[model samples]
Target: MTSGGRIEITGLTKRFGSFVAVDDLTFTVEPGRITGFLGPNGAGKTTTLRMLLGLVSPTSGSATIDGTAYQDLADPLGTVGAALEATNFHPGRSGRDHLRVLATAAGIPIARVDEMLEMTGIPAFARRRAGTYSLGMRQRLALAAALLGDPGVLILDEPANGLDPEGIHWLRGFLRHLSTDQHKTILVSSHLLQEVEQTVDDVVIIANGVLVKQGAMADMRGGGGAVVRTPDPARLSEALAGRGLTATPGSDGELVVGTEDLRLVGEAAHEAGLPVWQLSRKAADLEELFLELTSGTNRNLGPGPTEGVA
Candidate 1:
């Protein structure tokens, strides 16, 4: 089997009239790893994916897979497998027949349809009509269709949407196997940061259609502020200030240090005769980081309570 290739997007912008859906987005997805394309709702993630797949043209810039645009690929399905929507299948077709139709269309062998059904763990339901399948089964069928051509790259949007915990766990391992064992390039998009945090090695975060941050998950999580607790909070605050570290009082009256260096804060407190009660480094979780990055963008407001009610 052929390994995955690099995906590069440079200055990619998309606009619908005066509304900018994607603005100057730039990133590179390397082979042999799963990269998460993440953002809040209305952040242009779907628009960007559509543009990449050549379903929607970008107003400016380029999105390329293996140094060529998706539209220009001689054998697009054989190079990139994508499942942007699980409901894109014909409801009347059986699960196996759905994949068979796609494989036949792609000039793939009919036998490969059963292979994909088994590969995606949906062979037992292969004879079931898609309309009768549950949402989770539909997702599996969509994935099977995407892998029908045995493509090197997999692009999935919210693939875990309807999966149970066990199914989600299975998917995580499955994606990891594709990237690590099969050497496939995988790009999966989801607004649920916690789900993607466990599956992706690197992340490209966007907000309001603009790139907010992009880097390894380890680096992003490690770059968070620490919390320090001392009996003499004021003295510790002063000590941190003396040592060129900023300390602010947390809501619970604990001193929140601005650095991840627990030892540095402890030493400064010891030297200042402030008894250290607790000094723990706080790593930022994906949810916290995501909320911080996209705080003011497209937040939903609940309707006001009924006027003069009760």
Candidate 2:
């Protein structure tokens, strides 16, 4: 299979009447890694994915896979696989029948149906009617259908929505395997920051339909802040300042050191004869950062005829 290429979005914008759904969004998803596309509800995540897949046209700018728009790709299905929802299957059709129908439509061999069922770990329920399948099973079936073409890139929107802890664990490992072992480009859109935090290599965060931050997970988690507790807060703060370190008072009367190097703080405190009671490095958590970024944005609760009903 051809290796996946870069996916680029440039100045992508979408508007509906007076409301702008997506506003001047731009980012690149490189191959061979899982990039989390994260934002709170009503942050235009679904709209952005829709544009990327050519289901919704952007008002301005463009989204392209391998330097070509999704619709313009020569072999779109073979090059990109997407699982935006698991509810698209026919209720009456068996899971196997559902895949077989799609396979036939895609000109894929019938043998690939079994391959995908096994690959998705849903072979045991392949003959069951899709309507009777659990949410997790439906998700697995949807994923199998997406992989029917053996696409180089995978775009999944909330793929873990209905999965249990075990299923979520399985999905994390499966996605990493696809990126590291198979070299497939994967973009997973999710509002669950904690889940995505553990799964993705990099992240693109947005809020209020605008870019908030995008970078490697390491970079975001780096620059650890140290929390220090001492009997004499003034003395410790002075010592840290003497060493060119800014020490601010934390909420609980602890000193917050601005640097990740705890050794430096400890040394400064020891030299000043201020006995340290407690010291711990504060590693940044993605969920914390996400909440900080999108704190006041309107949350998209659900689809309804009236807004803010529930």
lDDT of 2 by residue, 89-191 (tens): 9999999999999999989999999999998999999888999999999999999998999899999989998999999999999999889988999999888
- In order, what lDDT does every prediction score? 0.86, 0.87
Candidate 1 global lDDT:
0.86
Residue 297 lDDT (model 2)? 59
**TM-score of each prediction:** 0.86, 0.88
Best of the candidates, lDDT: 2
Per residue, candidate 1 scores C-alpha lDDT tens digits across 165-206 of: 988998999999999998999999888799888889999998
Candidate 2 colliding pairs? none
